[model samples]
Target: MEDRRALATLPPLRGRVQQDAPLAPFTWFRVGGPAEWLVRPADVDDLLLLLRDLPESVPLSIIGAASNLIIRDGGVRGVVVRLGGKAFGEVSVDGDGIIAGAAALDAVVAEHAAATGLAGLEFLCGIPGAIGGAVAMNAGAYGSEVKDVLDWAEVATPAGVIRMAAQDFAFAYRKAVLPARGVVTRARFHARPGDAAAISTRMAEIRAAREATQPVRARTGGSTFKNPPGAKAWALVDAAGCRGLVRGGAQVSEKHTNFLLNLGGATAADIEGLGEEMRARVLATSGVSLEWEIKRIGEVTP
Candidate 1:
């Protein structure tokens, strides 16, 4: 097969590489098919080598945390790179700045910053996913966004790694114009000295609020759709009577209409189908089309 030949042509790597690696376990929903190739680079050098020499015919996809994502059942083609290990998960602080590897979970970064008496990043405790995905999507919660504090981010492209300033990202609500095929490796966020007690209190409040309102324990992907301008996505879903709606084994979370859950035996199709139905219902009732906040990838089953 072409995939096998493409694998053969890859330059030697220090990282782990696999053909037909199961991707379901890597995601929160616990569904979807295997990836054509799953690669975990040992370090930045190893990642650079793979990126610089990968065949042009093959496609490359980057995933992080797999928290707010849905990989379709037909699986992903070409290469899927998942950054991990201490090299990509380290979080440290220097003076008024915090440096976090792209693989670092947003909550871990928030904790690290708070431990060092740094404020302004406590909002990260409320956002799911890793720093890389957060930066790529301009993720935000509790009235703050990544763009509000990010100083700069380093991204790796086939050409080479480049350090881009926050302004260079041209961040918009829940989106950024990151370079095509560029993978975020790390980011620096601006912080300021604040009362440690105050920061900790803020984070705790966020955690409590999330637990009360969201389906934190279910097999679910966080927030199914983006909030339309001047309107809330969850309210629209509830208004359309989509709360607890079901398709196959997937159901809309009764606790939070914005979340879609896989009740043990759901397929990727079932979850995605339920989301489409929710959108249709909302559009029909509210005349506002919902945009997906969760990233969905790979081919649908034929």
Candidate 2:
């Protein structure tokens, strides 16, 4: 209701637009409230046109796989656009390089690369988020980050689409510096020729490591906080004795202190509050202050 005029104008949209759509179902944590307006564009052109034609007053936000995300209980205001289906889900091979749509899952891209004998991207198999969010935050695992292999990414901004190079991302630790509200649509990565069998074996090992170290079965956001400089975040959290700490229905994953889980019937506020408490506890135990890696959006209920 905050942007009523803008919402009313969406009926003519080429894509599906729903009012008060349930957002919790889209997320890994299975929490949060509704999306005031959820936009599902038909394709890249539809999305670009929608972004161009829409009023500037109506705030727009983008989401992908919903992994590593927490939408607050009050719900998101303005418009929430998610790229999905065949339109944004394609990953194509180009010689030793590959182009992945933003909506494409990291696992799928990894598999594609493996099948195509593309090495240097096996690490992406461990990341749970889609390529869009992965490029946005430079998501990675297994000693290889996105910045290391990403040649360029195509992003849609308020002004227009731009092909952003690796240097333009200004990536560091676990963050990327891009224009405000610029959404990634596609990414290009360069890989070397390798044996498909070897690539598959590496991906299998990554899967095993993830299963052993992370709470893959829990309703949780992956990696609650970024590891501070030289220290592992989980180590600090463990030292603080905050492992298995609980708040409301949410609890720190005992399997990995870096992950926070919603143990059924948990509120978004509960998860966020638990994260803050863990942060404080870790700070109290160690001098290092852990920065949140998970993206929290939307508002709290009034």
* Predicted model with the maximum TM-score: 1
lDDT of 1: 0.94
lDDT digits (tens) for residues 104-202 of candidate 2: 999999999998899999999999999999988989799999999999999887678999999999998888987867888999999999998999999
What CA RMSD would you report for each candidate?
A: 0.9, 1.3
Write down the lDDT of every candidate, Cα atoms only: 0.94, 0.90
At residue 34, give the lDDT of candidate 2: 93
Q: Write the per-residue lDDT of candidate 1 for residues 205-265, one digit (tens) a residue.
A: 9999999999999999898999999999999999999989999999999999999999999
Each prediction's TM-score against the native? 0.98, 0.97
TM-score: model 1 vs. ground truth: 0.98
- Total backbone collisions for each predicted model: 0, 0
Where does candidate 1 clash, by residue pair? Answer: none
Question: Using lDDT as the measure, which candidate wins?
Answer: 1
